[model samples]
Target chain A: MKIIITVVGNDKVGIVAAVSQKLSELQVNIIDMSQTLMHGSFTMMLMGELNAEADFASIKKELSTVGEQIGVSIHVENQELFDAMQNI
Target chain B: METKQIRDTIAMIDEQHLDIRTITMGISLLDCIDSDSHKACEKIYDKITRCAENLVPVAEELENEYGVPIVNKRITVTPISLIAAAATDTDSYVEYAVTMERAAASLGVDLIGGFSALVQKGYQSGDRKLIASIPDALMATSRVCSSVNVGSTKTGINMDAVAEVGEMVKALADKSPLKCMNFVAFANAVEDNPFMAGGFHGVGEADCVINVGISGPGVVKRALEKVRGKSFDIVSETIKKTAFKVTRIGQLIGTQASERLNVPFGIVDLSLAPTPAPGDSVAEILEEIGLESVGAPGTTAGLAMLNDAVKKGGIMACEHVGGLSGAFIPVSEDAGMIKAAENGNLNIEKLEAMTAVCSVGLDMIAVPGKTTASTISAILADEAAIGVINNKTTAIRVIPVPGKDVGEEIDFGGLFGRAPIMRVNQSSPAAFIGRGGHIPAPIHSFKN
Candidate 1:
């Protein structure tokens, strides 16, 4: 299954690096990435292909921990939700 | 993969309360009927538990898998009256309700509906028995919701049944006003409704089906805010676009849940169901459409536009749309409506008028305990007239809180919310309600 991880908070160095490292460690492959700075607040969206054996709950918890350490808010959601709401 | 679309979807879920309101499994209990009441009750329990064992888990899995919250997992069965009719030994159908409550509790479902009877024209023996047992049944069971269809477009209104249910509602409240919250009286009740306390598996439905009800009052309100001060055309267009997105999500979730449960997918009820939570209110949506408040003048016109636009936008998004497919105005369940009522801007009379243009009528309203059954019957008659003449679905789920007066409030907690006991007109309608006969179908019902 694919999931979208959105990060939004104050702009800081290595925001993408921190999030990407956490995903890689969990064996989740990055499929797409987008980053923008809006009024000095950093926003990034990462699409990742989750491994079959990975624990979704643990991965989400670990990502939130990483996000907290880096001063950002992280949200993980299935891509189908966005596709369903927008494509139709 | 567009950033804008992703952000929009996220905002809808995270900020606006876009949610699949309920995923109700309708299970027909015709085959469970037996001559012996005890055996019938056993079969009923077995059938419900066996069919709905996986409903909660499956709904939760879908909620996690699709990243959209499914607020309620519920069950609706063939109206217990039909099943109880076969049991010659029983004078009451309270056992049927008890068995349903057990099944619901065992399955971890939020509520189980269809403890109901349809007597739009007149009552049968079974309907009479079921109606007689409602007060006790509802008072005894926590999760078993009940409804009675006392009127319809083709058959007119069953004034006798309406009168009985009005007294039944009072009796229910006298036992426990909260129990009245679980009961509804409907005009033109739909068979596949996923919303409660009015959902039931109609006699015409399949043995088992899955129906989805979607909710997004917050999304519509937010969209209307964006078009603030715009013309009606822009406002309507914005609402339609937002409703399309909400219904599409409902369809997606419904299809996925049906496939997982291996149940036939029924209709998607595209209702903007509201909660007491901030920002998730149908009244707020109405206010956003240029009304000063939900019950203020021009509210009916605003609601009519919203109801029509939602149907227009949602019809294309799903294969089938049924249930009460419009904006619901349940006062206690909506923060804005509750506030409007508290501030004296919204009253029972205005709400009765609003029902002609909205989805349901006098929903989740609270009246003083001193209110008489005849007055309640009069209210039902008025609402039923609106639905019957207009050929729409209208219902009443008013609670007459026992020992509570006009200024007092009843806190049902959770999604049932808190209700301020609004004053009812003291004028007696005893003579009108006591004339118990069928209100004949309207002239417009001759569509042929």
Candidate 2:
């Protein structure tokens, strides 16, 4: 199933690089992503699909550790709902 | 997929704020009924729980897959009063409300609606019980909302039911002021409005259905912002064009969903609705359409022009344009309006005057707690007069916040937003409201 990961935290170096590396390692393909800086805070919305052979739990744990290293929060939501929200 | 189109769509979505206004699943509980009220309540609870068990997960999946925000996943069941008609006492109604609240909590929904009674022409035995129990039902529950339809195009106005609602509003507000905030009295309340308290599963609906409410006030406002010095015609055209794009998106999504859910698609309600944000204001659209100010003398005429154009464009965009399909100017929900009200420009009277030409009436307005039931009824009467006279839909959602007076602010959190307490004429119109007979159908209502 596809998933959306919302990365919200301080504007800093290496956030995109770190998140991309983890997803790539887990074999998840990044379908689309956008980053915006609103009122001095960084927010990112990412759409990606899970790798068939990858373990969801392990990837989430790895993402969390990355989140802790950068003082950010990571949230993953199913993509069908994301699309429905956009469409509706 | 066409790579170029996909790239363009992604680019268009990149800079915008998009979120699901609501994902309302309509469930018909008629099949859950039996001769016994107790057994009927159990089946009703089970059926709602079972249908909504996976709604959250499925919604979350869709959210992640598309990178869009699914803000609310709610359910609108068959009106509880209809299913609980077999009850011998008011306790069954309360029991049903409690059961629905519990089921919603189990399903992780924020609110559950359809605690309704259709008493347009007159009240039935069950409708009376349901109406009388509204104060207790609303005060007792945390997430259940109640609505009553007291007038319609065909029935004109039901004075008895309307008077009863006035008292019900007072009792509900007194019980736990917030409960009163959840009650809505409507003239032509829609069956498939995805927006709150009044939405319900009409008899014409499927065993279950999904209706969508698409909002784009920010987009429309920004479009207007582009033409600051443009002529009134161009500004009106801009608003209509933007509304068309938004409605088209809703049409596409609604059709896909109805097809996927294996149910017929309902209407795409093109309400130029607003949130509490600074930029998302339907009133601002009126201002853009050449009104010197939103609550000024020319405001009604401006709204008439805007409302007519929106309908014209939206009707051409979709075959089914139902619900309260017009511009909504809920004062508390629109930041621009709240500011206007706080400044002495917008008041309850002017807002009601503007409703002469708009869609919903006197929405999200907060008056002083001391305002009597008669005055509230008077406001409802005045709005109903406009509706009956003009032959359109109108409604009242007033919150008499206890201990709060004019110029004070009451925060309702979330989508209900916050309202800056508006001034109510301390002078009572008790004499007018006491003349309790039906204001004979406005002469225009006799088109038959």
Candidate 3:
């Protein structure tokens, strides 16, 4: 029900707005988000709830297309799994 | 309640080879040792179990909250040899090892370090016994680790002890070569390194602590990959920049953890330590940094530059910088290092030379067990000599694998990995090792 979509790759204008529009269209509420420029590369973390009907695969596939269009790579993972990475 | 910008930063690191290497719980065992060895062992087991009980769940919770991967949750205790010193016989070592193993197993920790001795000058009876029992002690336990500091700058080198430990290591290797993977010998060794078999809680540490080792050879490599064919100065700049970001994350997390755990936060070791995994080799970073191949001529100089630059950058990034906080090049642990050794481009001698400039000495190297203890001692003496002279921390995790010769392989499985049996200088340096005494502190050590 909850997903974190990370959009990273080339620094460009409207990257955030574009992703936000996609989430708005999908009716996914953006719970939290943050972005920063590290080492001149643009990185972003977006936490949002995916509509229950929208499975992860479809969301990922759609984001992949959007990512390809923008010349950046995108990844979507479960919030639970994302949190586990911090344990190390 | 995540902000718009935080989400974006997380997206960039995905599938990009960022993960927390370990979440180690530092437990003080000083309260455990008793005049009676059996009682001491019991106290050790009980203390470790109680302190580490919440480690896994707490780490899991932190992992969830922070969105960073924590690969291991481990426990580090006061040096086992110190606690086991009350033993009248060898069983104390075994009993202590077994108890530590059982306690670690209960806490679900994969391995525990500090099954160790801190004999920089000469051996105490307990230290001697612990060294002698290492082979059987390690062979009998699954998760226990052992370390001994045969020499130190303040104490010079203890050649005789180094030689004997070498022989004992050979015997240990002979018993179960894999178990040899769990021991380390050191110079100016730290008490709070989370990575092992070299890591051990030192006499200087608090009752419960956490040390963070942040590694990013891949991140460094990726940064270098961008500036391929750049000048050495540019490469240095790129490395410093990348190290800053990597260390910032460690500093943030370490501070947060120290505050939450209510223990004094220790250091953030900014070593670019590598695993056997691909794209994670510190040596590869060198090659990427303009070396034709690792272990080539000038390799040590290159490493010295890299190691120094990392410390400079890291010290600037974090207030509490400790541990073996230079680039680590353990031969068996990094695939790139193993490849270098396999290709004959890297040898024990060159590795030792590199350690003088980097963090930790002769780590995870497998030497021929049959070699005279004197030779092993010589190796230890030589490494300690460097540390003492330079007044820097260095260590040796040499495994004289039994029955394995130069170029042969000894597989220890998992993170310990397989070491290509490296050659030892056949010449015996026993006469030198036999004359053991304190090597007084270096002039540099007087700067305090």
Candidate 4:
């Protein structure tokens, strides 16, 4: 299923590198990506499709752990939720 | 759309109090009936546990996947009165309530509703027994919520049942005022209401279905903040836009749960139900609408606009919209309402006026232990009269705190929230209540 991985935190170098490395390691296919910086804070939205055998909860926990170590907050959610709310 | 939708949803959950309030699985227990109450209870237990076994875990999965909080996972069953009517020997529905509680505990569901009876017109066979048993049944079970439908728009007000409910609520309060939170008296109560202390799976509903209720008063209030000082048209339009987004999320969750659980999707109850947290209050939304305070003179007008906008927005977002879908003004459950009540700014009469525009009537209000039973019945009659004439759903959940008087507060804690005992006009309604029978349906009810 498609998912959106959002990373929001104070702007810093290597934030994208850290996230991309984690996703590549987990074999998640990043379909699209967007990033913006405002008021010294960074917001990145990554659209990805998980493999058939992917475990979203564990992947989310792992990514969030990386975010914690790097002083950021990461949210992983099914893209359908956003589609339902905003694209309805 | 430039990721704004994703960002907006994330902010709503993180900052605003957006949530799927309850995913209630409504199960029909009509087939659980048996001549013996024990057998009936056993069947009821099996049916509920089997139907709701995955309710909690499934909701958790949805919460995790969607990155939103599902605050409650509830179950509603056919009114126990109907289920136990075949058990003519059952004097009290306490055993049935106990069974419901056990099933709820076993399934890990938050609360089990449908410990109820529909006596809108008059009492049926098991109706009086169930009504008599409510105090005992509620006190006897931990997670069993109870309600009675005393009147309807078509059936008029059942003054007899309304009077009895007043005594029942007092009796429940006498045992433990906290249990009063589990009971509600209704006028024109719907069958698919997924809310607590009032939800019952109607006979017309399918065997099993998924009904969802949404909460986002904070988000709505935040939206209104942007439109502050704007014209009323802009204010209403902004609210509709926010409500549409909120109810659409509810629709997705309901549909997903139904597909996963193999249950039919019933409806999305689009209510701005508030929590005790400061930011998440329907009253705050009204205050945001420019009311000095919730019980202020212009409050009803504000609530009417909100109620209408929510329904209008929600109707387009989902196929079916039922349940008590409006802005809830429960005194205790809402942070803004609690503050207003504690300061003696919000009175019971004003709340009654507000109820005509909102869904629940005098909800989560606490009165002095000395308040007479007839007074509570009179309050119910007034609210019922509003519902009957206006052709809407109105419910009352009042707690007469034992050994407490006005101004003192009772902390129910958790989702039930807290309430400062509000003064009830002590003039006795005994003569009016004593003239019990039926208050005929309003003239508009004769549309046929």
Candidate 5:
């Protein structure tokens, strides 16, 4: 299963390190990634794949906690959610 | 996907109350009919439970998977009158409603509709029985919702049923007025409406199908805010664009749900339904179009424009669009509407005019407990005339809160919301309503 992880907040050190480390710990593999200072806020988009049996809800909960620890907001959703809305 | 678009979607869901309001499974019960009432009741219960067993679980999984809130998982079946026709031994169909309620409870569905009869032109024996049983059925079950088609553009209005329903509604007030909330009298009621208390699986529909209703008045309002002080053109366009995005989400969810349930996908109802929640309100969208409050001057015109723009915007987003696909203005279910009614800015007269331009008519309104049955029937007649003449759908779900006068309110809690007892027209329509017969369908002439 594919997922999209979005992180947005004021710029700070080790934001990517904390997020990626947490994703790796949860057995999520980062297949693609991008980042930018969008609208004066540090924003990152990470596309990842999860195991077939992995739970997205618990993974999302853990990722958000990691984001809170780093003073940022994180949202994780099935990639299909974005595709369904944006593509057509 | 572009990061900007992704961000906008996230903000819409998180802050703007964008969500798929309901994913209703329409299950036809024609084959479940039996000569024996007990056997028929068993078939009704069995088919509903079997078909919708996975509805709540699948919907919950989808919600967690996509992170989009699917607020309700509901079922609409073939109208009980049609299904109960084979059971001639029974005079009341309350057991049918009880069977549906039991199925809903076991399946964990939020609501079950189609405890209804369509008597627009005339009544069948079963239709009369089902209509007679509606009040007791409503009092007997919590999740069961009932609707009766009393008029249509093609068939005209059934004034006899109208008069009877008025007395029936008054009777409901005598015991538990809240049960009145479960019933709707519709004009030109659609076959595939996914909203309660009017949703029923029309005989024309498939054996089983999935239909979704989308709601996001907050999203449209927020979009309009970005184009504030602009002309009606910009306001209309903004609402259309926002409605398109909101409906796309509905289409996606409906498609996925149908595929997973192994049921054919029906249509996405493009109605911008609202809740009592602070930001999610269709009335607020009208207010954003520049009304101080709902029912103020220009409210009906504003609603007309909004309703048109929503259809224009959402028509292309789904495989098919049906149901009551206009902006809904149910008073008890909308925040801005409730405030307006409480503050004297909104009244039943203005609401009646507004219904001409919107989807349902005189919905979720609470009238003074002393309001007469003839007057209630008169309200139904007025709305039926509007629908029949203009070729639109209108429905009435009024509650005559017992012992409550114009200044009082009924807090139904949750999505049922709270409704202020608005004043009703005191002039007795007893003479007119007392004279019961069919109102002939109007001529579609160029003489207008």
Candidate 6:
């Protein structure tokens, strides 16, 4: 299943590198990525595919830990929900 | 993958309180009927437990999978009056309620509906028995909800049933007045409603179906806040777009749940049901749409537009839409409404007027215990009249807290919330209600 991971916090270096590293560690492939700085605050949204072996809950916890280490707020959600709510 | 879409959806859930209100599995209990009451009760219990065994787990799984909060998991069986008609050993239908309660507890459902009777035209033996058992049944069970349809557009109002239910509501209040919260008096009640205490699997519905009720008053309110001071057309358009997003999520959840459970998908009830939590209020939506408060002069017009826009937006998102598809203004369940009522900005009379446009009528209202049963019946009649005249569904679920008077509050706790005992007009409608005969169907209903 595909999921969307969003990170929003102060602009800083290594935010994308850290998130992508965490995703690669879990064997989840980043399918899409977007990031921008708005009024000195950094916002990034990434759509990733979770392989069969990856546990969704653990990935969420580990990513939150990474977010804490980077001083950002991370949210993960199933991609289908966004498609359902926005496409129609 | 649009980042804006992802962020907006997240904001709707995390900030605006967007959630699927209920996923009710409607299980028809018609086949459980038996001549022997004990055997029938056993059959009823066994069938419900078996059919609903995985409802909670499946709903929770969907909640996690979809990343949307499914607030309630409930079961609505065929109206117990119809199922109890075949029982020969017992005249009282309280045991059926007990059986339903047991099934709900075993399955871990939040509430089990259909402890109900449809006596809109008249009463059968089972209907009478079930009506009589309502007070005791509701008082005894914690999770069982009940409803009675005492009027309809086609059949008019069954004044006799209305009169009886008035006394029944009072009796329910007399014994643990909070039990009155579990009972709904309806006019033109629908079968596919997933919201309790009005939900029931109509005899005409399929044996098993999954009906979903979607709630997003906060989302709508937030959208309106963006268009503040904008024209009505802009406001309406914003509401429609927001409702579309909300209902689409509901369709997704409902379809997935039905597929997983192997039950046919029922309709999605696009009701903007409110919660006691701030920012999750239908009345606040109205206020955002330029009303000073919910019960202010323009409230009805605001609610009417909101209700219509929601339906127009939701109809395109779901395959089927049923139940009371409009903004609900239950005082106790809505923080804005409760605040308005406490401050004397909203009252029962204005609420009665609002029901002509709102989805349901006089819902979750608390009245003084000293209020007479006849007065409660009169209130029901008034609300039913609005539904019948307008050809819409309206209902009453008022509680008359025992030994509590106006200005006092009854705390039901949790989702039921707290309600202040609002004053009821002391005028008597006993003469009209005492004349127990059917109120003839309106002229519009005669379009044959």
Task: Kindly report the fnat of each predicted structure, to 2 decimals.
Answer: 0.74, 0.13, 0.06, 0.94, 0.61, 0.81
Candidate 1 regions with alpha-carbon error over 4 angstroms: A51-55
Instruction: Report the Cα lDDT for residue B15, model 1.
Output: 93
Models ranked on DockQ: 4, 6, 1, 5, 2, 3
DockQ for model 1 equals 0.69
lDDT at residue B124 of model 3 (Cα atoms): 70
DockQ of each: 0.69, 0.14, 0.12, 0.84, 0.67, 0.74
Q: Candidate 1: deviation at residue B267, Å?
A: 1.3
Q: Rate the local accuracy (lDDT) of all candidates.
A: 0.91, 0.74, 0.76, 0.91, 0.92, 0.91
- Can you list the residue pairs that collide in candidate 1? none
Which of candidates 2 and 3 reaches a greater DockQ?
2
lDDT winner: 5
- TM-score for candidate 2: 0.82
Q: Which tens-of-lDDT digit does each residue in B108-213 have in candidate 3?
A: 8878988888887676767877777777779889888888887666667666667777778767766776776688888777777887777888777888988887
RMSD of 6: 1.4
**Residue-level error in angstroms, candidate 1, position B192:** 0.6
CAPRI-style quality class for the chain A–B interface of candidate 3 = incorrect
Local distance difference test, candidate 3: 0.76
Q: Candidate 2 regions off by >4 Å?
A: A1-88, B1-16, B89-92, B259-264, B288-293, B312-319, B440-448
TM-score, cand. 6:
0.97
- The positional error of residue A24 in candidate 1, measured at the CA in angstroms, is 1.7
TM-scores of all candidate predictions against the true structure: 0.97, 0.82, 0.83, 0.99, 0.97, 0.97
Q: Give DockQ: model 5.
A: 0.67
Local error of candidate 6 at residue B241 (angstroms): 0.7
Model 2: per-residue lDDT, tens digit, B190-292?
7877667777788767787766666666666666778988777887787677666666656655665565556567777777777786666777877765666
* lDDT for each residue of candidate 5 in B1-448, tens digit (9 for 90 to 100): 4888888999999999999999999999999989899999998889999999888989998898788999999999999999998897889898999999999999999999999999999998799899889888989999999999999988889999999989989998787888988899999999999999999999999999999999999999899889878999989888888888888999989999999999999999999999999999988888887889988999999999999999998998888999999999989999999999999999999999999998989999999989999999999999999999999999899999888898889998899899999999798999999999999888871344
